[model samples]
Target: MRRVLSGLVLLLAVLAGTTAAAAEPATETVHYTFDGPSPLTDVSGHGHDLTPVSRFGGAFTTVAHNGGQALVFPSPCHAEPCPRIALRAATTTGLNPGRRPLRYGASVRLAADQTTKGENVLQKGFSAQGSQYKLQIDGLAGRPSCVLVDDRRPQIHAAISNVGVADDRWHTLECRRAGSRLSILVDGVTRGRATVPADLSVSNRRPFSLGGKGSYPDNDQFQGILDEVWVRIG
Candidate 1:
């Protein structure tokens, strides 16, 4: 009878430990549909909303797309202090999943004529400052790419897709970082993949940004339309 009681106690302890571990805050999601009347509202329940920054009064607007409204970026500028426009989180808190798995992406539409050397879709932290995780369209090809910088060491890993998304059509682009791999997916299809440190972590004070980094020059401003944007970390 004593042995049976001890065994039962051990089983309950094990079950309780497992349940507690599962209840830990290991997963978080923030989503911006951009379909609502106010683009700052976060529909993902995590309440990671955004604040807008623009150089011009009406540089950024919204248009109907996918049966709902979508955010539109400003046109390309070749001069200094151009019409800067972007959306940024009020704070960086809980947005960086550190070394844990992370996925971020957006539904984008851009014309070939609007393509630039680089168009930042979203980013947190700067590569030169500690660590960062970013998604962007690169070069005149308007190729989608994902970049991850490790805070444990000086490392910048990127997976750039060959598929050009700039053709005046809407496309879903996803950037995923898991374990030792960084991948970019277009329309739920894998387009590129690369390797990185498995235990890397990215933590920085920079605010999470969309469309561009701010009004600063060479901000990698995005020029196009963005529908649903989301981030998931675990």
Candidate 2:
């Protein structure tokens, strides 16, 4: 009976160890698949829905891509008020990663000809204000980069990728913030990385913007298709 008791205790200890070593799943802060009529709807049950604020009525629309629906922003936008969407700062909840490990990304498809001066895929807060997180395709290169400014610091931590994603192919681009490290991933592979402050935290009262900032001449508009945009905070 003593041997049997010892064996049971050992089994319990091993099971406990295994449970402790297992990884915990990240929480879905907000997600938009852009697969249905309600493309701007946040299906993650977080109620972080977006509102379209484009000057051109047809700037924001849906197109079929990759065996599913994808949100489309006018190529070149040509003029001001190019396609854009936003979530109000007051309504944005569980979207800020304050000193937390965060992962946010999107599936993008852009032709080379669609490149713009700057394209904002996702942004919250403004760098000028001192605390922000932005995922944007920079310059005419169409290379995605992740920017972080935390703790009201004026300095910007940018992780820029060399790979241009405007080849008319569906590529998954992700920005990961793990402690002091920030990384840019293309197609599930790390393409760029930068070291940030270990205690850096992003918390601000700024509306989340996508595709572009506004109807300005230089909204940094995105000219492409985006799908499965998500933000996960852990």
- The residue pairs in collision within model 2 are none
Q: Candidate 1: TM-score?
A: 0.90
Q: After superposition, how far is residue 115 of candidate 1 from its true place, in Å?
A: 1.2
**After superposition, which runs of candidate 1 have C-alpha atoms over 4 Å from their true positions?**
1-17, 23-25, 56-58
lDDT of 1 by residue, 184-232 (tens): 9999999999999888898877888999888667778899999899999
> Could you give candidate 2's per-residue lDDT for residues 1-234 as a string of tens digits?
999999999999999988876865447488888777677888888787887765555366788877778888776655555444432323364677888899999999888888876788888887878488888987666899999998557799999998999889999999999999999999999999999999998887677777776655566777788888888888
Q: What Cα-based lDDT does every candidate model obtain?
A: 0.87, 0.80
TM-score per candidate, chains pooled:
0.90, 0.83
Top of the candidates by lDDT: 1
The alpha-carbon lDDT assigned to residue 39 of candidate 1 equals 72
